[model samples]
Target: ARPRVGYFYTGKTGSEIITEKLMKYKVETFQSMPIVVKEDDSAYDAISAMFLSDVGTLFAVDQDNNLVGVVSRKDLLRASIGNQGLQDIPVHIIMTRMPNVAVCYPDELLVEAANRLIDKQIDSLPVIERSNETGAKVVGRITKTTITKAFVELARNELM
Candidate 1:
């Protein structure tokens, strides 16, 4: 026997919902190849290019495409201003290690993922999933913008 309960079941994937209704479900999906740098890459050149790429941080890679670390814009800039040798140095010297990385899976709920972002106080999270027998592979990126835009659209529809 099914339990009786009143539930406001919302239909999935309808353009008729308007912007507001869509906002709440506007979660990040798997997309966008992550910008990456190798562990042994020249820090100066890599950092410069990454900054110009307009990403908050650069994903550091090993010989394989596996994500190993993250180097933030501030860290790179500080290193650059402090040591001329930083240009020749490898990103490993300034990267946050894999153990410290705050990552989420592509299937994670937007509300739960957003909470994790708030708790970690990070601008974005690299969406990853374990591949075969290898390390985690990044599939997408989730930024605060993801959720905000969703909510904004929903609000717009509700108001209209």
Candidate 2:
């Protein structure tokens, strides 16, 4: 028997509602333009590129413009403090090489990308397209900030 004395029915729990909304988002809708550097570029150059772009993560690409590795501000910082000059150390030396790097696609669910970021303990994921025969071409990036923006926007929409 249904309780009708004082209870009112709600369609879904708050968490359930949020999850359903979040699940509907795809990475393409929230991704930001990728910041990339050549694999052979110096660590110093990578740092400069990151600083100039105001991005913490930089995708390292080969001559073919295929994503070869991923580097972070921390990696550049570590290399900068080493005995060797930052200018002398190639980005490939300090980057997390491909296959070892976590990546997502534009069509991937935003929730899955968020989970990937959490599970990998990474700051961002390079959005890649595998249709190319050369290799995976980095298309965009999904960062914690991007995910936060998505959540905030969703909340704002709900409030309105």
Candidate 3:
């Protein structure tokens, strides 16, 4: 016997369907590899890493690979355009330090992370994982692009 296909929809609005899909989706499912830089690294190196990785943000990690700060392309550009010796400056000087950064854990919902990105006016969130030895280690990164990709995928799935 064949199964039914179109019985699920009763009176759901488009917004409702999208919201339900987002709520069920986890951030970890869509997060991508994070580009990391050392806090003491030169700003030039940090910018180079960003360009090489084709990412707009970079997580500054400690020796233990624990997240310490976040640096954005805007941060680097702002620092670079004004000073002649900007390249010599360290990333820690320009990065948004820990405790000030908005982060999301891997187990959290992607919608929550998306809200954080919108509310905080940021482009990315460092996906952290609590560790006994390293405190909060950056396991991955979720960006606006990631969120958009997820939404597109959800829309495609719904259409199909």
Between the candidate structures 1 and 3, which one is better when assessed by lDDT?
A: 3
Q: Each candidate: what lDDT?
A: 0.71, 0.90, 0.88
> Per-residue lDDT of 37-142 in model 3, one digit per residue for the tens?
9999999999889889999999998888788999999999988886657668999999999999999989999889999999999999999985577467888999
Lowest-sum lDDT 10-residue window in model 1: 22-31
Per-candidate TM-scores read 0.72, 0.89, 0.86
**In candidate 1, how many Å is residue 157 off?**
3.8
Q: Write the per-residue lDDT of candidate 2 for residues 1-160, one digit (tens) a residue.
A: 6567788777588999877877788888889999999999999898889889999999999999999999998898888788999989999999999899999999999989999999999999999985848699999999999888877887689421
| Per-prediction backbone clash count | 4, 0, 0
Q: 100-120, model 1: which lDDT tens digit per residue?
A: 989877666666677877999
Of the candidates numbered 1 and 2, which has the greater lDDT value?
2
Off by over 4 Å in 2: 2-11, 158-160
Looking at candidate 1, what is the lDDT of residue 79?
Answer: 83
**Model 1, 93: alpha-carbon shift in Å?**
0.9
Worst 10 residues of 2 by lDDT: 151-160
